[model samples]
Target: MRLLSTIMLALFLVFSMSGAVLAQEAQTNTTDPIIVGNQDAESLQVVQSYFETMDSNLLAEDVSYFDEQSIQAIEGRDMLTQSPTFMYGDSFTEQQLTPLRYIVTEDVVVVEYTFVGRNTGSYATLPATNQLVSVPTVGIYHVEDGQITGIREYMDSDDLYTQLGYPAYTGVQPVAPFTLPEPNAVDDIVDNPPAFYGQEVTIEGGFGEMVGPNAFTLWDEDFIDIGQEGLLVLAASDGAFDFTPVEETMLRVTGTVYEYDRASLEGTVGYALDEGTFTDYQNFTVLVASEIANMDNVDTLANVDQQPESFYGQTVTLEGHIGDTVGDSAFVLFRDQLVGVGGRVLVIAPDFDPATVENNQVQVTGVVQPVDAPTIVTETGLTLDENLLSDYQDWTALIANEVMSVE
Candidate 1:
């Protein structure tokens, strides 16, 4: 069972044997089927169960498919159960596998399938690339007497990592999470993030630093310093409590994950939206904490200045001399009132009727979320069209969850 996993990443037929694929190509009901004997039919069933267990991430602790006398040449049954072949679900939000071919002989069953999913989570030791991949793999199972005796699997690892947007593994395993996901890890939100959209979950991870009045970055234990792409969290709890930064061991219950729509406004005032895109989605797993506590000894959270680009996804407070307005709801705050080249933070409050913030001094509190950054798109197959910050427009800002205390 352990040795039989790689079949999902193996065979990738450039084209089907014919222009038309045989949908009902079953050998059982028809005169031409792959079944040989009763054992052959059962072996096929066993192989199917193996893939099902893998997809569900419920690898049996005691591998019943292989006994002590099993000749698992490539690896042992226990190793296979915990092996990378079975760990695909750990990093991917969705791994949809569909069988392509099944070549069954007397005692051996070889199967082919295509594995398609977005790489949103990390491998054992590697970080997530947040890319999508679709590839074919081959799996072989050897049945002797009754139980599976041997197994062989092949996955196209040469460019699989590159395709999935991750560096090849170098014998490193991903760091274990402090607390199990109410289903997934913190970094798991990167790829196929929309899968967890609108779902209420409790996630745990390290406290990277504080971003704003009540916003902070929750770092994945494996890649602590990776960046602001995945670890931004906002507290939905009462403002009475202040969150202190600590190690990767805090818990959040109201974590709501969402993605930003970059091209929402282009021709609007001071708005230059990037139209071209690369990745299908760029997500941030946010948490409005119902409850939070620091398990570490550190009491200080790293403070970032009014650097909106640097503080993307962080909740920061800015006291600036107000400047101008864009539309009915959005206004500008010129922190650098003299030079004005340092750029400005756009404050949009549509809920606040009859928008009334003047060019006076005021305190702004909100998340410094990125509006337009670099994005990846495909011109053709391998041809990539990258959208950089300078390519369109750039001005990360404090999206005011609440703007108050005008002075």
Candidate 2:
């Protein structure tokens, strides 16, 4: 990307005076090449020979063909280490240089050629685009004794870069207009819903079931230990985003948290939360999202199992198929229950109906806690059978806030 600008500037500084002297020297050569703008056979041969070496990728021989002053000029542009095929060879594949025009002016041979190639390599740090390009390039060469004594080349670098998928050049790297602070975890916001109420905050969590045209649930899979179900997201204003949410996709929501209230939400969103659909969400935290994006990384159940102690009080989001059912409100969740592979975790969802998601994929968000049947019964008010209680004793369990069927 920097090649054209660097060479132009360097040549302007180094060859301004040397260029005139080179042309004069070329005019004094034994063949006495033409001083007018007409095609001279010998001058064409010298320039063509140089390009032949380039098209053949003959680096050492091509460098040998250039005189000391021309070599220094090329080195001044930091091109000494490059192949004779030059920047185009490094940034492109299947290169073909077809000389389109040759004009001899005052003993200098001006050659115009079409550089055809596939963009299969990086230009500086820019990535390869795998695109084909055929751009015109111009080069001026001073020949004396059939050797290139001075050289200058020109091409539209911006056009080349943009054709290969780079943004329009502003002579510098582009910067974002604004930056957002790190997002808060949905579990942390849920841990004390009132703390985030009425405040604009960004929260990251799992994408839950869509309850309305523009509203959906966002939950932390690792936050199941609590009694809350999930944070309801009101995304009614913007319509759908440019992506479809899947089971493993984690979403980051930036909005103001509000205490769930139908009348209050209807006033803010300009639409009703619907009577029967959101009845169970009363007293829960609701996020009125202004922006939403996918999170690059999210913690999984296997990540928790690798170091259970580290996530004892942390909220986690995990998606998996429902495993063996322990009771009406509890079931074993496995990353891949069908193959009996991957990590597994115990989930206890109060008011959950196992029949609804018998063999379906589900995402669970909750806090990790040690499996104490007595403590669980005290916290969740679940009447667990003796055999089930004994089976999970001394183990780890996620006290789920939300459990939803997923893809």
lDDT of 2 by residue, 201-254 (tens): 988777777775777778774322223468888874646445576763578788
Q: Give per-model TM-scores.
A: 0.29, 0.29
Q: In the order shown, what is each candidate's alpha-carbon RMSD? A: 26.0, 26.6
Candidate 1's TM-score reads 0.29
Q: In model 1, how large is the Cα lDDT of residue 235?
A: 48
Sliding window of 10 residues with minimal summed lDDT for model 1:
375-384
Quickly count the clashes in candidate 2: 19
**Leading candidate by lDDT:** 2
> Number of the top candidate by TM-score?
2
Q: After superposition, how far is residue 220 of candidate 1 from its true place, in Å?
A: 48
> Which residue ranges in model 1 land beyond 4 Å of their true spot?
1-40, 53-76, 84-89, 166-407
lDDT of 1 by residue, 1-407 (tens): 11122222322232223233244443244433322224337667666666566432232232323211122222445766555535363677677776666655555566666678878777545788778888666655665444565554556663577686656534322222122225355766654667876666666566655554455666554322312365456545334346445544444434566544434212111233223331222355454455565523211111223344466666666555444554444456543311111235555544442234321445667766644322211111222222322332455544566655342
